[model samples]
Target: MGVIDWAIVAIYGVVVIAIGIIASRRQTDTDEYFRGSRQIPWWALGFSIIATSFSAASLLGGPGEGYTNGFLYLQLQLGDLLGYGLVIALLLPFFVRLNLTTAYEYLEKRFDAKTRSLGSLCFLLFVIARLGGLLYAASLVVATVTDLPMGAAILLVGVVSIAYTVVGGITAVVWTDVLQFAMIFVGIGAGIWTAVNGVPGGFGELWQVAAANDKLALFNFSWEPSSVRSLPTALFAYGILAFAVAGTNQQSVQRYVSCADEKSARKAILLGWFSGLVGVGATLLLGVLLFGFYSINGGLPADIAADGILSHFIVNAVPPGASGFLVAAIFAAAMSSIDSALHSLSTCITVDFYDRYVQARTNEKQSLRIAQILIVVWGIVGIGSAFYAASTGKDLLEFLVTYTTMFLGPLLGIFLMGVLFPRVNSSGAFYGTIAAVMLVIVGSNMGWLTFPGIWRSAITAPLGMLLGYGISLFGQIPPQRALQGLTLWHSSKQAQALGRPGLEEEVPDRGDY
Candidate 1:
């Protein structure tokens, strides 16, 4: 990167910090800090949701997948769309009506305290592990572009993200995400333009090269259960992966809960799908560009390994000033995810743990302080984990991504059992989660659950959910009033009151900056 690129990165950092400081004033209460006082514009929230979900993993990992494996990876996203649709149709209404602060709180309302706490604990572990990987990936991009030490770069990114997240809360996260999303598009567009302009045959030549190398093929339509990358596995297994991510994950669910109502939430979710499709398309295009650039140039630099395609091209292929912008774009991808994780983790700890146990009658000011402090604490933990991951010589991003999925199958199973199977008692849900998680661990160790050849993991959530529900069914009690009490889909005065516009009035909801 040239001096101009450094200037751009410095300016971007300043703008993000300023936004965080400005948003600090709005962090006067727990509700505002956690949910943005339910006042964010649906468009901004929608874009923010896209930005958060499209992490460094998506930006870099997607292209890497394309470069190595072809368009077969896009099949995973098919289930992703279905997952978001399901969330909009089912989960959004339930969360909006209840005015939830954290996603796991729904478990408490439907089951028992133990279920809620267990769910929250799973989310906490997943976010920290995943956020560390995001930070590591962004730091690696910085290291490649600017020739900085990876650990130092990781620390730098972590500190800047934490500075804003601790102050700005949800408001800062959403607004800054809009800017980050724009940066991502600009970077992708610039990369695509450069690729096309430099190539002899343009897009046609690019597609021919990819197809010649077996990178352009999309469908793998086959139903062999043991075949990992077959069409059936990509459609069904990846579908389950998408459902687990969009429907039950705290980070995605929190975005919906922050919306004003179910209608707005639905709109936001639908728009998010469009944003995701555009983002994925751009990422795939970038991969094709990298492939063409390398084929024409007789392959990449020696230091540019299999996983470093995007970073290497942006640094070596793009002009000096443009490299900086691409770096900023990479930073945007990482921060969008890390900041949201920090915000959600803090919210879960504060609302789910501190408020529920530490101080039941705490005032707004005290709640806000606890939340800010927890953000700092979790940020430090993530940074520490990044450093440890770096020293261990493991692929930080891959490790984080795989570890997070280990929890997803179980979490999805627990939630589905609670919501769809009313007979699944608190004990059943709790034990079912343990069993599903154990199966994941055991399967992974036995190599029966290795990551599929495709981009997404192959250990389908449906199998886990079915196993959990099956287990819960055996312990089912006969029809009783207890089942009726557990029915969240049934209407009540509380539900009707929640349906009213002034429901926030009855709750005296305090508010984010």
Candidate 2:
């Protein structure tokens, strides 16, 4: 990269840190740090959610999948779209109505302390691994451009992300996302433009190349069970992943519950849905274009990995200043994901564990201090984990992602059981999640599950839901008055059957900010 490009990257980093410091000024307590004081406009929260979703996974992995297998991967976006609708229509009401700080707190209200603790632990594991993957991916981009060791690149990315998140909390995370999202668009746009103009005959020639190679194919209507990447199966799996990530994950739920109103939250979530579709389309289009570019020029080099194609092209083909912008976009994607996870992890610790158990009764100021301390602690731990992955020289990201999926099916299932199935008891949810997890481990490793390949991924969540609900029926505790407004059906009938208004109305308006 040229000096001007390097300067842009450096200045961009400095601007993000400054945003963090400026944001820190408004936060007087844990509520602001953890909740964004519930004052951030819905549009900003929505944009932040989009930015977080546009992580290195989409920037690199999306294109890699497109390059490898054609546009069939885009089918997953259909399920993702449906998942967002489900979240806004079905999931957001309970989360927002509960006035949650960390989304897991709703589990405690609906279930038991043990269940809440379990949920929090799942969130921590999920986000920490996700953070590592983003860092690793960003490191790959740096290694491609600067010839730096992957470990060193990972450390540099991690430190820049953690620096701001530890100070400004969600405030910094959201505001910085606004800038990062712009950089992402510019970078992705640059790739698309180059792919088109670099080819001699433009869209006509690109189409001819893609058509000849069958790279434009987008489906597998065949009824094969083990074809995990098939359109139907992939769509279903992506839906499950989105449901878990958007509906049940702390990072997303924190944003939903932090909105000014349900209307704002819903709109913001819809914006996320829109962003997902648009962003995936852009990257996939790039993949198609690159297919044409390489076809006419000659095939990819023997040593160039599939993942490295985009990075390699940017470094070697694109102009230096432009390459730097693209690199900054990669960095921006990493920061978007890491900062949010740091804030979410810190909230879980402070609200779920520290405040709930250790302090039990800390004031707002005390809570704020603990939140900051946990933020720094978790940030350090996340960076250390990234360094560990780099040092081990293992393809550890995939293992962690696959391992996390074992929990996703159960985690999403438990949340559904709580919100949708009123009969599912705390004991049932706890045991059912445990059962699904154990079975998933055995089934995934042994490759003996009746459900084929990634079809198993989609099926596991419903299996978990059924297991939890069925077990609760056997235990059969009597219905109680307190169950009102916490579950979907219960909340509706509270006024008619119990002669009491909904409990959500009791969620305090803490506008003290």
Candidate 3:
């Protein structure tokens, strides 16, 4: 890139760091650091959720999926709408009612300390793995453009994220994400305009090219187990992925808990659907455009890998200054996600581990310090993992999509049981979660169980949940007494009556906004 391009990237970086430092003033205590003292507006939080979830995966991976598979890949995203709806309808209310500081805290109250710790551990593992994949992807993009070593790029991204996150906390994360999301859209929009102008036939011609190449089709009706990309498998795998993202994932769930009440939380979730749809849809469309651009240009650069398609395009195709802006945008995507993961992981460790196990007497300031320290530690670990993953030459999308489910699916199953089935005891919930996780691992490794043949992975979590729930019911009697307690929505009402405004009121002892 030209000097102009480098300047654009540098400017974007400065703006992000500035925002974080500004937000840091508001984060004077643990609650404010972790959840922004629940003062963030629904719309801002909704956009932040979109920004966080989009990630480098969506920025690059979505287009890659489209370039290779066509519109049929969209089936996976369809499940998100349903997944978000379920979270709004069911999971949000339950979390709100509990006034949960960490999502795992609910597990502790309903089950046992072991159960809560187990859940937290699972999340911690998933976040580390997933964030490693994200950092790796971002590093690849930067390295591709600037010809830097992958390790250097990875360190640069990790340090920037850790610096802001440790200082500004969740408030910084939310506001910075808003700006990052805008930059991503700007880059994507510019790419799309350029592609459309260059192509002779516009979208119509592009569609024709895709159709001729068998990319326009959206479904494969075959039900046979042998097919890897059939309609059923896509739907089933996507459904599970959606459930994990919306209902079970701590990073996503934490955003809901950051809202003022159950009502606002639900609204934020629903609003996020529009952002998700548009963001994903644009990425996919850009993929089609990328395909046409490369096809007409007589194929991509010889060294361009499948996952590097979008990055390759940005560095080679976009104008000088704009190219750096796009590069910064990629960093923005990675940072948005990593920041959330850091905060969530720290929150889980502090609330679930330090507070519950090590020292019950710790005050809010002490807790915040502990969390900030954990964030730095995890950030280093994430960077190391990114270097390890880069050496494996794994496809970023496949590695992230498959490994994330290893733990998330079982967690989802256990949580579903806990909230939906009041009869389930701590013992049952504990054993049920374990059983579900084992089933997922066994099925994935052995390949004995398969659903929707095109989806190579086994439906372990869903099936395990089914089995675990069934096992729990064998000797347990249903509760004859009505479950007496406030639901998640009603908990908001209780908080309001108690003069909490559900989340708007800042706890004085906690400090800051």
Tens digits of per-residue lDDT for model 1, 1-513: 779888988898889888888888767677787888899998888899889878876787767766767766666567678778767665676677768888787776666667788888888887887877888888888788768899789988899889989989899999999999999988787777777767788877877887788877777886754443467765666566667777777888888999998889988887887888788877876786678767876887676555588887886678867777778888999999999999888889988888877897999999888888998999999998777666655554456646666667667776777657766766677766776667766776899865542223234344545665666678755233223323454444544554532222222211100
Q: Which residue window of length 10 is worst by lDDT in model 1?
A: 504-513
Candidate with the greatest lDDT versus the true structure: 2
Q: What TM-score would every model get versus the actual structure?
A: 0.89, 0.92, 0.89
Clashing pairs in 2: none
Question: Once model 3 is optimally superposed onto the true structure by TM-score, how far is the C-alpha of residue 430 displaced, in angstroms?
Answer: 1.0
TM-score of 1: 0.89
Model 2: per-residue lDDT, tens digit, 1-513? 889889989989999999999998998888888888899988889889988867865687666666777787677677778778889877888788767787777777777777888888888887786777767778889887888887778777777777788878798899899899888888888877777787779878987887888878867776555553576655666666677778878888988988987888999998888887787777777788788888887878888766687887888788767777888888888789888888888899889998877997899998888887877788778877777655655433253445456555567887888888878888888888888777876876797765543444467778778788878989866245335777777764554466653655442222211
Name the regions of candidate 2 deviating beyond 4 angstroms.
Answer: 224-228, 387-401, 445-447, 450-457, 476-479, 492-501, 505-513
For model 1, name the residue pairs that clash. 26-513, 32-511, 32-512
lDDT agreement of model 2 with the native: 0.77
Error of 2 at 407 (Å): 2.1
* Root-mean-square deviation per candidate: 4.6, 3.7, 5.1
Model 3 lDDT tens row, 1-513: 889878888888889889888988876788898888899998888988888877887788878877887766666556677678777776777676556778886665545567677778878888888888888888888788878888899998899889988988888888888888888888788777766766778767776777788877777778734332566655566655677667777788888889999889988887787887788778888888778777876888677776888887887678766677677778888888888888888888888889977987999889989999999999999999898778878888777876676767767766766667666655566677777667655765798754432232235555545665676676454231112232233344555665543433322221111
Q: In model 2, which range of ten residues has the least summed lDDT? A: 504-513
| Candidate 1 local Cα displacement, residue 403, angstroms | 1.5
Model 3: residues >4 Å from true position, as ranges? 199-207, 224-230, 443-447, 450-458, 466-483, 486-513
